[model samples]
Target: MAGEPQPSGAPTKGGWITFPFLIATMAGLTIAAGGWTNNIIVYLINEFNIKRIDAAQIANIVNGCTALFPILGAILADSFFGSFTIISVSSLISLAGILLINLTAILDTLKPAPCENGLTVCMAPSKTQLAILYTSLALSSMGLAGTRFTLATMGADQFDNPKHQGVFFNWHFFTMYAGTLVSVVGIVYVEDNVGWGLGYGLCVAANLIGLAIFVVGKRYYRLMKPQSSPFTGLACVIVAAFRKRKVFLSSKSEDYWQETHAGGTKFVKTTPTNSFKFLNHAAIITHGDTTSDGFIKKPWNLCTLQQVEDFKTLIRIFPLWSTGILLCTPLAMQMSLVVLQALAMDRHLGPTFQISAGTMMVFVMLSTSISLAIIDRFLLPTFEKLTGTSPTPLQRIGVGHALNILSMAISAIVESKRLATARSHNLHGNTVVPMSVFWMVPQLVVVGVGEAFHFPGNVSLYYQEFPKSLKSTAAAMVAMFIGIAFYLGTAIVDFLRKTTGWLPNGINDGRMDNVYWVLTVIALINFGYYLICSWLYEYQNVEKNELSSSSPCPC
Candidate 1:
């Protein structure tokens, strides 16, 4: 009965009626987020007179925050506020941040003066200006953090069927990429070719529109009620297990606790899993652990079988989740570096047309969108038809790991060629390389293809495996790992700047190719680690249909 659409004349509260409004809001907000974040490095370099390397570092940190803060938002939504409230408040906060950023672009006093006569010695931004800029970035990142993954959970809540949820996710990511495509190509172009003020102002407008659309849909959404913190239950499991460490194992079913309904009827009739045997102590019944009415006497010393199993599920999935961090770092680094590469290359598409440096990331989005369509519409069904079985999320994630490593290798080779071209032309001291920007497209496209495979796999895996009480948190887990990876990317860049000559003030003076090669090696090692984790992992909550079919459709 889940995910069933209402009849045409029925006054239902959820289902297809909510889809248009949510998708529209997604597009508007994604455009708004990408409008500023995609060009942030360029904004820092050109507007604030920050060094290129410094700007890239700042961008990495900003990306880290944007990705990391989603977990907090997810926790709050799952524990205190529902998704709708968080989305609404976060949108307003985002609008404020965008407006402040626009003010900086409009008012000359908020930014440092432009570099004089192509000289490198330009006046730095005042402390007040830097503070304002940093605050705006923080607020914007926080706002985005609260809404991005939460929206996915909110949308999924409308559907009761797993197949419908899967379909919704596929379209959700497609909409995400499509919105980003418009921002990087359209908004970023305006920022580069027109003026920063107009570009940021457009972002402001997009934010307002997104907020308005979400607010107007209040009556139709199937809102989930907030519950007590799922994390507290997880903590209780850990504490109770440690407290009852000396308790003997119980082979008899009667010795363990099973949750019961208010009328003394058993609610769930399962025992703790054997995977994490030590934690099973938390569910073992002991003297005076429960009252006459079966209420827990010491909450921290005793936990239900379901809570113990949920905790164990987290323990099992954590290794696989850890694999994503290293896997993500190289990709993050590659993305940040590519923007810098675009700046030095000839970005002309044709006579009188030039691509903005920031717009270089558009290839990643474009290729991802195309790949998603192919995999969902053609590849998945075709594979199922031929093989009689669907690829598991782990399998999809493994393929993504291999492709990501290949992309890194390709990037190393391409960067080497670019460096060779620079040497051949005797280019140095901020001189642009004569190589075409299109040369970088292959690497970006490969990264995109890899993303299409891995990102959704991660979401599906976590959402399916996590306890139902933590649905929003489950969706946010992807953002958490990615956020950590971005932070790692920043650390790696800083380490390289301090320890190696690969990245100098001007990239042409350094060996940028060597950095790519290092990333290739790192990715290779990470892929090996990922393979082990994926092979060891067993699916805990795979849907019944997934065993036989790969199609997203319920039929």
Candidate 2:
């Protein structure tokens, strides 16, 4: 008989165990996802013969789906199946999606006929074609969502050291950004120059390779079982608190029921914090709330003080998270618009060498990859040595906000200059402007730098502070922000086109600079809001003692 599968451990046994396999898996999956998505708008336009803005909207929908599906995956991981199973299933699903897309790319019947070079009217893709295309995207989006950040939590589970966990985060994102670089620069180039069929075929290969590696390393992974839904506990906390609203507040910490020790045993707990005092009522024992041994008689009637405090932590963190949603809206719009700009501007490096517009995102990915390595290895250490303290997540995120504000300003300025050049050349209505695509790099690079600080900061913060049971959800919350931002960006673009002349059918005729300016003002206001939230918020967990930090009450 085959050897029995390895059992789950405390994950403290292995010192930085399974790092290599996990990193490889991450890198491969990144390439798979990035390669497929990097040139999605170009694929839709070229193959389906769709209009520019319409193609962007579809791409945004894909991006949104990419962001949204992870939450479902995470919830299932935390409340039912574990991460490894989810990752395995998702990888297979994603592989299937890539294969479907590749099929579409290879077969002429799956897409509309290629438009003639000078013709304006082109055939739209058939409903059957659109159906297959959407099915492929949906499968791929679900696959990407389930595997990416859930793997982050899985990787972190292998490390006992808080600092080691933090270090893992850097490499995790570095792999992510680095893989994106390879896809956009290398694979997207193939899509543009060689062929889409081969490009998506490579994506399928990458996904399969990643899945195989992860399976081979399965025995080495740290595994955890599903517990009760974190959501139900949070809901109970709210309901119990409201039901006991009229109960007299307790003066003694000992009076509250604690999860760690409930019966005759001494335990220590900080009396619930003064902020959100109304929530403290959740722990107040009303009639029939508890049994003789101080155990909860009814789950909905009473919650442990820990459950009450967990709800408070989420509520407190909401503002900070909301700022992150707004933070990416401008960037998301700018990102989509930049590709269009690249299409209109000069992309030639010399007489022979020309670049793909889709590949332009490589600059952002490159900047993020390099900057993350520098920050994680050099800058953070140097700052700590000089200042005797490492930068807090809030501080790092604030820096990101500042950088974002600056990037928006730069984008507005660059777009203004591009517009001036376009106007001088009398460019209008689908004509290319005589400007260099290089003009767009500064803004893209700055946004990348900003992400280096904020993206990891946000992930690190959520991972550290979330209730242990909700770890999967914690990592996936950042995706929620991104998904919301992309959808919001699409809405904003639609509003601009309908309400104002700023975003016309052809950006050559539209005042794209004015849209950038509007985004700049919005970013500045959001940054101010971020500053206020960051100032008021205190760190929930800064220590290596996970249990003590997460539990306001411990025995």
Candidate 3:
């Protein structure tokens, strides 16, 4: 009977062990690249004399590039190369860019002094050097976008049976966060002691190692060949609509429009010319009445339109998912602006209490890791047992949004206290705030908790809603939203800095605690918006059941 059905435990054939290893390797490399760049924001402010706000803007640019290129990567991966091949090629390209950045540092070190007026002095690199640095950053950003979605999808493909799919997703998220954990410690060491060049060089080395591992595991991968582009999907919908119009107009009797036996199977007969003409004319139907011909036609392109309509309908039902965008804005701020604030604050870790910007990040990472594990392994299962139904991904996301608001509220309180401390001490002139940096830990921990709930839940929701052929594209959409949030946050911060005459005083002079409060307020407003959106979301259990019954194959 169907060859004894595939086991629910794991894939029996092929090298499944290599799959998780491959995913972990890629995750480590991506996290290293991301963390190294994120930490550079602090380095730029301290060493390059860049303003905190300006540094944040630069970081936004990097995030934006990474986000935008994913659309391109998704298109290529879906329409041209399979995910495995695309990821392999993209990883190497990213590695090359990282190496180029590292080489710049080596060049600087090797440069000799020039004699001018019999006094020897080392000459600094020109503006051209800076331009090249940015170019390399852009390349690396593109590489990241190209591989992020493809690799995730590829990892999921290793498990083919539906019963094993849940476990696969659990591991996928676990591996991603695990990679971020390694980066927090590894990149911090390179940046704090070894220098920026060495840190970036290490990223290059890590990426190369990841690429090699993936390549070695090629035999174990179950590759899905690329399909037609999303544009093709759209075109098919349009064509099907027109064809249905023709079928509608050809039949004239109501009986013809009713279900009838055709080829020993029931088929719905449709009206002829009138239905086709009606669609073509875009005539507004104000009343429900039988046509003169007594024939009626259902809407054309139901299959394609249903897919698009379901997306729109699902969006309307869950307002919270959309509002999560607001929560995402502050979340994005953590890696850039929030970190900058920490850098300007005193970070003295005594034997009993320790606080550093990088150390705070470890807490954030740990919180994220532990929270995700709890949710996937225990919380979800327990909830399912009680509710008799697992919570929809959108529902999970809504909970995360609420937690995000809490995170921001904590941030506001902490920053208010820090601001008061600065004002009381008349320590306004110092580059670093005099207050203990440990005050920021609560907010950071809250952020990590929020992320754990949101990121994986949102990803699962997007994948479920997307058409099977467009899974990568759907994943890219999720990434795009995050990129947009960062860009928008940067824009708002820039506008506020210019309008309030706070640019030079806050960012340049290092009294940015006030700016932090402003972000906190923005996040609260977003939380309110998120609540409104969440209220509108509808759980589509029926549709999900139908799809699952029809297609037994797991995504």
Candidate 4:
């Protein structure tokens, strides 16, 4: 709380950078990032001559790396530099990365020559070519990571009212998904039909424009000053608690670390809770913990009461977070494999019109975008009108779990049918199946709806439940979960390829139905685990009166 900056204008967040400008900036960046990433699998396969399964694995790895970088951005924004500086720097970095990718796409020497045949006999990129390709990928990934989630936090920073913040979140997600939908559908089509050079060039232009918009509006932003992270305090609590493990905790509030008016600072004092009794030792005033003047001379030897409580909050919600990992892994798996499935399936809507394989996931993006708007406008209001309360985060996430399981089951059935048609034509020998690509839509739509329920719900839980000091990083937590799921999906794919014939390079030749079935089982089990975690966990921030009309007020 030290050295907090004064607000610039009225409640509308400093009155300089308005909501529309920030939203526009976010949309542009989202479009730029999505355009390049959406069809990365196809690019790797066609342009680099990577195997189908290998391309999918690499895609997942790229997804994971890009998603994971946001945590570091959040940490820096909250702990060192503010969002404006970090965002500006990140935007430039991202612009540079996109330019590099565009260069590779434009210069033939940077890539391998076209395979006279197909990938079966195509010349792979040389070590030098690979180094340039990887460098471009890494730079682009880093650029994407720096801005994606940080933009969310920055957008929320523009509003004063909690209600306005909530509205911003909905619109933020809506814009992000909508922009991605356009990229996956429109730009990906360009990459698929027109050319990679032109497609990547569009992304570079988009990134440049986005960064320019953000920098122009920089002075108007309401900047939140960075303070030392409360996680440091939490760590101090753990260290002090262990050091004084044998020390007994007292019931007196005075025994804890709360600032008594001594012309220095102000801090609220509260009695320790009964739930986490052992951690109370950190707050217990003892011989060497405090100075003679009553201040904590050695910080590592003591902690504030809030620090202990904050640590407890994390422990309570981690199980819920853990369960959602598997929830997301199935979707990640579906996303990568579905592209490969589309590549090998009949994509013609008519003799004249054919769908690009990369554009198939646009259905998922569209479904999520529509569902977010509907859930925000109609579903939540209708539920509150019926039940006299909004749906709890757990309730929303629970619905996501059920829908995810169903999506996996649906995916399994569709794949099974696709395989059956492939076998009927004796199409295992390098032949594309006759099954319609439209068959992939149902499962994608279901999973998108699930994401609609779960993604925001999980983010809300983290922000509500996390300690004040950790609020900045709370948004990044969801991004980190997504990254982990992508990595886990990669591992699952690799394991299946190495162990069994269920995941051959060609899904038509392998038993893809079994892979989906396995994903379904994993989802079901993780859903059960989520239920248990939700049942046992308590909310850290929910008001007592609000709890009455919905779930039990356990906390």
TM-scores for all candidates? Answer: 0.93, 0.90, 0.77, 0.92
Local accuracy of candidate 1 as per-residue lDDT tens digits, 102-159: 9999999999988876696889999999999999998999998888878877888988
Candidate 2 structure, TM-score to reference: 0.90
Model 2: colliding residue pairs: none
**Candidate 1 residue spans exceeding 4 A from truth:** 1-11, 160-167, 264-271, 542-555
**Which should have the higher TM-score, number 1 or number 2?**
1
lDDT of each: 0.83, 0.81, 0.60, 0.80
lDDT of 4 by residue, 1-555 (tens): 233455587443443346776788888888999998889998988888877899999889888888778998888877789777888888888888878888888999988887675435778899998898888888888888888778777777777766676667666766777788888888888988899999999998888888888887766777788778766788898999998899988878877786446664354557889887888888888887766666778899888787888888888788888986788898888889898998989999889788888898888777776787688678988998999988887898899899999999999999899889988888873468988999989998988788778876777677677777787687678878888999999999999999999877666789988999999999999998998989988787865212111111000
Clashes of each: 2, 0, 16, 0
Residues 1-555, candidate 2: write the lDDT tens digits.
111245487333334668888989999999999998879988987888878887788788788878867888878877788888999999999999999999999999899999998786889899999999999998998899888778877787778787887678667766777788889888999989999999999999999999999999887766777666789999998898888898889978876767746355344665777879998888876678667775678988787788888888899899999998888888888778888788888999998888998988877776776777678678988998999987877787788888888888898899889888888988886677788899889898998788888876777688778876566577578888888888998999899889998777678888888888888888899999998998888878766332111111000
In Å, residue 332's CA in model 1 sits off its true spot by 0.7
Off by over 4 Å in 2: 1-17, 161-168, 261-270, 467-472, 542-555
How close to the true structure is residue 504 of candidate 3, measured as C-alpha lDDT? 50
lDDT for each residue of candidate 3 in 1-555, tens digit (9 for 90 to 100): 012235599565433675666666667566656555656566544434444567678877787667667777878876777777778778877887778766755565322232244322324434675677677777788777787667766666666665565555555555655675676677765666668677777787788888888887776666666776765644544554455454433233332223223333233333323312333211111123224543223333332222343334434434544564566677776666566667657877775533435545677777776776677678878997999887776666667777776777677677667667766766553246777777887877877777777666676666676555555565566676777777877777777677775445353343354555666777777767765665654444345421111111000
Q: Model 4 has how many clashing residue pairs?
A: 0
Candidates by TM-score, descending order: 1, 4, 2, 3
For candidate 3, what is the lDDT?
0.60
**Which candidate do you rate higher for lDDT, 2 or 3?**
2
